[model samples]
Target: MTPDATLAARVTVDLDALAANWRALDELSGGTASAVVKADAYGLGAARVAPALARAGARRFFVALPDEGAALRAVLGPGPEICILGGFAPADIAVFRDHALVPVLNSAAQARAWFAAMPGAPAGLQVDSGMNRLGMEADELAGLLPLPPSVGFVMSHLACADEPEHPLNARQLGDFRALTDGLGLPRSLAATGGILLGRAFRFDFTRPGVGIYGGAPFAESRPVVTLEVPVIQLRDVAPGEAVGYGATWTADRPARIATIAAGYADGILRAAGAGGLAAFHAGRRLPGAGRVSMDLITLDVTGCAEIGPGTMVEILGPSQGVDQLAAAAGTIGYEILTSLGSRYSRRYTGG
Candidate 1:
């Protein structure tokens, strides 16, 4: 069935734009461009996103957990390499083997387990340059054994790559270099932000996540997803009437309001309702009203009186980009993308 034919709100993914973003990042990388399809392609649906990326020339992909890797493998089939960032547990090792998934060993114990469990299988090493969130710390690297024949690449993450001038970017790059230098293995130190930091941080591969999905700090990236929310109702409010829960918004003058079908539960962050959030219809803005409830959002559509039930208002599109909406909600683009809920009927557009 067609997505628009249904009354439910919908999210449309522009795969061609996504591929263009990947190409842009790939050009910037001057190295291998590995797509990060983790978190179900940052909640855009890996089943669809992975194949789009593969068609766009991504030979390798990264996922956060082993199960995610297995799921991606089902969609991507045998060719493209799938790497897991969440490290592996003994119990899940069999799934990795079954799917030919590579786990980025973050600790010596994980390395030992991976090598012992599947010595002939390919793997990757993640050194903790500065993030310290995952990967092996610098101090712990000295005791680590030599990379096995199956070791594919050595990688580290940049904590402040998005800040450009942040000292940690350079420090992390230097640390990554010092640790992997002369190792003759493929080395990586960048994601989307690091890719923009230039070739110095590119290493051998660049895994651009949010950028390919149309988010910052890849500001040049094209918009990839458009969220069209269906308006279910509209009403005229008296000058003194309050709107929505908490009685937070009271009209100083008569106003036209619209209630959309999706809300916070659909990933339209609650904090976004506090102020300056709006939906768009035919290039016109409909300011948000009151608080964002679990399943609905009230819009102050006084200026958009022509809009009514069944009319689709754009919540995230040309008029309201993901970053802009994220800014209004006091969050990052990644959070906004990953938090996208599954309730919306999703449509894949473009190639």
Candidate 2:
């Protein structure tokens, strides 16, 4: 797609890094990494992301809601199982059944609702490890559970997997182990962080969500996403010239400034302009100048005279990895990845 057809913004998902990241995490999982493609593959296009993962040898996938599962199923060609991590809404049973989606029964009420009326369908149980985000409580699980015959996969979430040595890791491990030991079901208790925790967390199936797309699933993961933006307009500004909204930045010297076509509305956080980043071309460095506007960013391009309008600047790619971008934004890479907008001329690199 032509860059001009876009609305002054673009979001390219590096599928190559995604697949590589998945493979790395899979190898870490002893070759059992089922990617979590929820939230549109963290806003990178689930249809493309899920299949890209499957091509990288991932068989299972997870999504948050039945609708997300349905979209994943559509993208993956109808047969690979999608575990609905959001469980089921009171009004969503028919939708789940219609889409052949597996609802991770989080509550006894949901389990009983499905078991009593639906008779048979593939379903799973989600145990709340330390996250307590979603899943069945331990006290709630012991009262003689009602599980479907087609319990294809069982799972849990890890709240502290990023900090491998966090005490909650072992506590969650013990709790999850106490709950699912020899349950005769394919159990998964690890997200990206949990996978890095160790082989102990690697069950029959493991879901590495953020890691696959390169959001540092583990604390030490090499970054996976690299985003690039284009320089739109370049002009000379006097030392005292004000830049962007609220006149927040004043050029320290006579500066050649290049405007970048990205900002908070386009997912580049506002903090990215607060002296947090460096824009570059080829190998030359350029300091970001002025406050980030809703649709543009200014970079002091004084010494780098070669870069001009249409020159591409690295946003979050090989040159500017997500960690640096996160550091620039005062947030984590996961937030940056998931918040990426969908208006780019998305190009899938590698396989």
Candidate 3:
């Protein structure tokens, strides 16, 4: 039940960078910027990320579930608004009412439930422009027009905003405009990707998620997380010898290999390792060798400038970021962040 006293693989969250990211997204939105702190602030610790965003001037926060909203409401207290994007069943309304959380009604049934449960409480509306994922479909959205008196905002999510030129962006914008036009309620159509789609998509409010956490599609955002994994041991491997599980990687020539303390179970995707990822030490890149085991990874440090047992190798930082790791893993930055292992000691810096 106890962690190793020598363990040094820690996830460093740059709170200052987090706050700055919010400001950057806010500037791009040209309207109020709400922080989407769901999934425990994308697994970067919502308890820490939320207040930093609040200090950065975010007046609203969005979470995907009621439990997340309840946790956020505790950290945010009474001032800033917390909205649950995942509509609730009748059983979940009590938590919403208890925490004074807002639910973004995604369906007529949800809307009816929310109204019947708490008639005068504030809520928002989500229309399914084209994503067809969540939100009310166009035909059903019309019947609820002019909205109830307590409706605070109308919003839609963009399906292809990251592509920039994807037709769905414009189509969703037009469709969202058609559904929400003249309602006079605050309208939000952009997240990090949509924020980059220009001011037209900004509308009255914007909610950004990954960008603030230093993910792509918002290229200008600063890196917010640094993952350092410690080298547990180093050894020399001869030509024809292999490293790690399955003996997948062999040394064509004599090589120096380092066994790091973290691996797939630590959230370094096995796919990323399969793609030949690298760790950084003293600005030198060390390629991973063989399979990424549950709790260990072998890195080829033959030419690494400097490395040894107890030396911290950077898995994610300036040399290699979450996006790069995601690319290597055939995934996305969001997954990489949210998948970070709970095993690592976490440290937050510069709020």
Give the C-alpha miss distance for residue 119 in model 1, angstroms. Answer: 1.4
Tens digits of per-residue lDDT for model 3, 274-333: 886888887888888988888998899897646767788899998998999999889999
lDDT of 1 by residue, 1-351 (tens): 134444689999999999999988998887489999988899899999899889989999999999899899998899999999988788997899899998998998988887788878898889988787989876666676566678879998889988999998888888888888877889888899999998888878899999998998999999999999888888999999999999999999999999888889989899999957889999988899899999999998887656877888999988888899999899888888988898988999987
The most accurate candidate by lDDT is 3
Error of 1 at 184 (Å): 1.6
Error of 2 at 18 (Å): 1.9
Taking all chains together, the TM-score of candidate 3 against the true structure is 0.97
Q: Rate the local accuracy (lDDT) of all candidates.
A: 0.88, 0.77, 0.89
- What TM-score number comes out for model 1? 0.97
Ranked by lDDT, top first: 3, 1, 2
Could you tell me the C-alpha RMSD of candidate 1 in Å? Answer: 2.0
After superposing candidate 2, which stretches have Cα over 4 Å from the reference?
1-9, 217-224
Report residue 231 deviation for candidate 2 (angstroms). 1.8
Model with the higher lDDT, candidate 1 or 3: 3
List runs of model 1 lying over 4 Å from the truth.
1-6
Model 3 residue 300 CA deviation in Å? 0.5
| lDDT score, candidate 3 | 0.89
